[model samples]
Target chain A: MAGSNPGCGTTRTFKYQVRDQFGQVMLVYNMQLWDSIVTTSTNTCNLGGYNTTCAITNTGPCNVGTFADGTFNENLGICAPAGHLVSGGCITGCTTTADQTWNINGISLSGDVKNLSYQCDRSW
Target chain B: MYTLLLATLLLQPIWALPPPPSEQGLQVKLRANLENYTVAAETFPQALTKVAAQFEIPMGIEWIRTSATQREIRRSWRHTTVYGVVESLVKSQSGYDFAIANGVIHVFPKGALMDRSSFLNHRINKFEAKNEFAGVLSYRLRELLKRTISPPLPSSPALGTAGSIATGAGDRRITFRLVNASVRQILDKLSLATDFRIWIVTYPEDRTLTETGFRRVASLYTSSSVADNEQPVWAFLRWGDALPK
Candidate 1:
């Protein structure tokens, strides 16, 4: 996803991995950064053999899928297709973005990728 | 007479004994001089982050929801100890204090250290990692918490753990062994073991879990702005990246 600067302060786009309880990346989401204000783009994708789009608001939970057997097939990169469906838990994680500049008082110092990365969570 | 002597020895005040090595080491680090540090104006967390980066000290900050901590502060010190700098910073803001534990400088509210309900107070039976990325370690801790604590207590909220580390080659990793340690102690160990010596855990102003019943997950970052948020976030900092250019 692309982020627009709009010539205000600074804007950056970040790639976030939405992982399950086992640290498996279930889906990916892109975020637009405006200074400290962050907004998530609605992403629709095929995950775990289920076609679904997670409704992610600003720093909100991205309910990816509720698999029957509580497992996603690693080989197929989707949920196993042969189990009964069950209620799945919400996927939540930290939504804080990394800033490109560190402002101490009035001074601005450049920042790097090591500053911050996007994160999300999953439960088995 | 020997039994009486033994009884008297056992009755000696705890203060008479020397502090543990970790506490002593922390005390030394706190006494180290901070030369030529100045900030025109910044929030409490901002100033603390700057000082930790400049001094290359392992520091962790846990913030509570309060307006007193949100106010801006200003200070200029030509030469002063880290302890003095931290003391002044804590004094600049109300409803906060500092402590040295597991050889890390931790700043939090006065009673947070003893708050049993805090996630920091949760105990881990065993944690051993070798050359693990700091973010991965954080993920492991979250998994451990879910495995050990959540299933038995169905009413407890599931902790949403997230972390981001520097990708690509040359990323920093850590190795350590901890047995029967609290979440706070593990964080302190991470601070001392990696270049990401600075850690911060923030809380939402509402101080309530979502309707889904999950406590605000702590997000681990390599480096980031000290900006406060309405959501909970846990972040770490690399001293090298935070240095003044």
Candidate 2:
């Protein structure tokens, strides 16, 4: 969503989160200005039995609770309007064009696997 | 001596004592406390209505009707008789008058109402117009003068034709192009184009006056300055006040 202008010589930030079924904190996605250049948020998840299940917390200031039923897709990094599909942020394919790079450590046989970080792109 | 005193007392009449004021004679009484009422600038009629309402006179209806109902009147009152305030309001306007009928004061046009004999005795004020078909503007001018213009009872709208005057004294086309014109100006324009004379009106057996020429004749008028901020200036045609010949 295109948030309103904070006015001349000001800034604004939108905060997001991922929690479990019982509102347990699992991830924090904060989109903010990079010193005055770009706006992006980075987070990781596990999918395909990758030892991760995350849910989006669209609460006010960012309250989209109407579609925050906990279901999310791994590849698209999106959620269904009414179901609870849990997946991780890590992908098997490697791409050099990634903007963010991080490490994902899970309970599977995966070691400290280096992976490209991602953020949900919502532009209005 | 006791018998004589009793006869004297009984002979005195109760009517000798003067009666108190009746309800009609009593001054206006406010239903609310408005001694400190100071409002923003408003028209004369609006102010009069506000002041009258202090004495519980109803507002928000066409209580006042006249051609010269002043739009702006600035005055105040404190502990004055209601009719006195009303008289002051009447003085604030021109070509306007008021009357008390059945104990309720009404502000109306100068010649708004008249009896059958009086109606025929009075003459419609002299009016002059130079632009447009004075005939059409006459009715529109009358509409502007009324507090509540009584439009002809609704009927299916239709256009009846009248031929040229030279051909057989037929109908003529009157034009109107006024911009913020006053009631007097409108009446003037109507007088010039139409024969300033208002004919006694008549209706055909067909229930429409489209054809004209049955019997009765009367004139009406109204005026006010209550148009809101965007008092429109009509300018469809170049029909302006005709210059002197």
Candidate 3:
């Protein structure tokens, strides 16, 4: 399911576990700077699940939380506002290119493990 | 006869008592220096309103109004009417704050002191704008004393007098010349590098007769020492940057 595209009129579920170190979960819905949206939920848990039905309203270049509950199941479809191109890009930690980089507060992490080595990207 | 002598002895020197300052005394003293202040009054504008708004404590003349009643009229024709003016002064731990409580009318300081004084003195003295607004410096100093010392009301009471005239006619053209020439001259003296807007507010009504009861009329705004120009001018400038908000 790493690169699967879930079509319209369908719901997809991804099971995730949040580690104890970072107590917050953040899902980056889109990657465009001007049209970006990030949703944050909080709790300490190693296991959690989120099911998102994708349409023309919630397309994303997505990134999950850093630690516990950081895993996400992404359903992909054509979701773009007017004057925007529907697009998809993979993101992990805080890096745009590296799938395992964890960036927070403008500092980037180095280790592959969740919450270990991640970048701190606090620029808003 | 002994009782009468005793009463007289006990009543001695009441005549030597010092009298309190009278309202008539205040008015007489003020009028003697009336040549100094440019007295005018009208509905206050919003610039003054903003200054008054800053103060939780009121300062200067705030609420002013007039009323006529049947009972007052019955006593005397003048008694029927009254003009009530209220002023407030505030002392903040930071500094002094003053505001008038009037709903819309109040005293807000304009940054340009000398220019305001110049125009005001010209009004009071009825002079042809010799740039003598600085004359108000002495008058303002005098008012400081009045604010500190004078009693609130006068025994004689103030008799209000007002008149106005307008002109765009006749060979004299005195009104037009005075207004236009004075404004132009002042503007010319301002810093050339900077631009300024000028406005005139006349009392009673903007369209009132050329002669009117002016409590005061002044320039609404001004800046200091236009660029490099340094001339010893003082008036509104005396308050400096501590101008009322």
Best candidate according to TM-score:
1
Give Cα-based local distance difference scores for all models. 0.45, 0.26, 0.20
Q: Which is the winner by lDDT between candidate 1 and candidate 2?
A: 1
lDDT (10s digit) by residue, model 3, range A1-124: 1222222111122233222235334332211110111223321111111111110112211111122223222221221111121123212112111122223322333332222111212222
Cα deviation in Å at residue B12, candidate 1?
53
User: Tens digits of per-residue lDDT for model 2 on B20-108?
Assistant: 22235423342233444342234554555455444533211112233344355666767555666666676666644765432234454
- lDDT-best of 1 and 3: 1
Interface DockQ of each model: 0.02, 0.00, 0.00
Model 3 local distance difference test score: 0.20
Best by lDDT: 1
List where candidate 3 sits over 4 angstroms from the true fold. A1-124, B1-181, B187-207, B212-235, B238-245
| Model 1: lDDT to the true structure | 0.45
Clashes of each: 7, 27, 56
| Model 3 docking category | incorrect
> Candidate 2 lDDT, tens digit per residue, A1-124?
1222211111111222233335564332221101001112321211111101111011011101111322111111222111112132212221111221111121121221213222222221
lDDT of 3 at B39: 13
Find the 10 residues in a row with the least total lDDT in model 1 chain B.
B1-10
lDDT of 1 by residue, B172-191 (tens): 34667899998889877766
Give the C-alpha miss distance for residue B33 in model 2, angstroms. Answer: 12
- Predicted model 3 interface RMSD: 44.6
The lowest-lDDT stretch of 10 consecutive residues in candidate 2 chain B is B160-169
